[model samples]
Target: MSATGVQQVVAEMLQPYLDQEGFELVDVEYVKEGGNRYLRVYVDKEGGIDIDECGRISEYLSDRLDDKDPIPDAYILEVSSPGAERPLKKPEDFRRAVGKDVYITTYEPIGGKKEFEGRLLSYDENELTLNSGKKTDVIPTDKVAGARLAIIF
Candidate 1:
């Protein structure tokens, strides 16, 4: 199966378990690294997730993947927490991140710049307003190439 296909299958399979555990499914990736293929699942919860939680999620997903047999080749299954700089993948993520510092890169330049680092002032469905110094930038979500929480000193 294709990488995206595998991710979708895994996400569907893991949703119930995550919901029951009060964990949020951050993201999932099926990718090749060197000679090995890996299925990585990033999960999060209210505070943070511990090693024990990761282990349990791994064990559960491993068994489910084995039974379903989605992938044709031998692959590593990994379940873990999205760390301090977790990715903002969904609109909800952006919404929740309002008032926090963030780093964002656009697919194309906005105001002749593709990268933005500042405090997130607001986030609507289509755009994000960021405050950088004395200026505020309105960035369209479609233009975002990458975005993550910024570590403030």
Candidate 2:
């Protein structure tokens, strides 16, 4: 099975368990590093998640994967928190991140720059407003290539 196909199967299998546990499914990655293939699930919830929560999720998913037997090759499974710099993958993520500091990269240059790191003042369906120092930049969401929470010192 393809990577995305595997991810879809895993997500579908795990959704019920995650919902019952009050956890939000953040992202899933099926990738390779060195000679090892890995399937990683990023999960989160209000007030953040702890190691025990991750362990439980991991164990449950492990059992489900064993039963489903989706992937034919040997793969490592990992479940963990997305951490402080978690990615903003969905519109809801962007909405919840309003008034927070963030780092964003554009697929194409906006104002001759491809990167913006600042306080996220607002987000609409089409654009985002960011305050970088004294300047506020209005960036179209379509131009965003990547976005994540930023730790401001």
Candidate 3:
């Protein structure tokens, strides 16, 4: 099956388990690294997730994958937290990130640049405001290609 298909299937299979366990599904990736393929699921919660938690989730999903047999080829299966700089994909993620430092990339230039890194001032449905030092940039929601929490030095 296709990479996106594999990811979507795995995500759907894992959601119920994650929700029951109070874990948030952050992202799912099916990628090739060198000669091997990997299926990685990133999960998180209010405080943080630990090695034991990851191991448990991995074991649970491994069983489900074994039964469903979604992927056509052999691949490594991994489950873990998204870490300190978790990606902001959905609108809810952006809403929760307000007042936090963030890095964003747009599909097209906003304020003559495609990248913006600053404190996320606000995010309404239409646009998001970012304050970078003395300047603030307001970018339309549709323009964002990717966004993530930033660990400022």
Residue lDDT tens for model 1, 1-153: 888898899999999999998999999999999999988999999899999999999999999888988889898888889899889999889988999999999999999999998999999988999998778999998899999998878
Which candidate model has the greater lDDT, 2 or 3?
Answer: 2
| Ten-residue stretch with the least lDDT total in model 3 | 74-83
Residue 45, model 3: lDDT of 89
Candidate RMSDs in Å, in order, are 0.9, 0.9, 0.9
| lDDT (CA) per prediction | 0.92, 0.95, 0.93
TM-score of each: 0.96, 0.97, 0.97
- Runs of candidate 1 with Cα error greater than 4 angstroms are none
Question: What are the per-residue Cα lDDT tens digits for candidate 2 across 30-120?
Answer: 9989999999999999999999999999999999999989999899999999999999989999999999999999999888899999999
lDDT of 2 at 50: 98
Q: What lDDT tens digits, residue by residue, belong to model 3 across residues 27-142?
A: 99999999999999999988999999999999999999999898989899888889899999988899999999999999999769999999999998899999998799999998
lDDT of 2 at 6: 92
| Model 2 root-mean-square deviation | 0.9
Count of clashes, each model: 0, 0, 0
Residue pairs clashing in model 3 are none
lDDT against true structure, model 2? 0.95
Clash count in backbone of candidate 1: 0
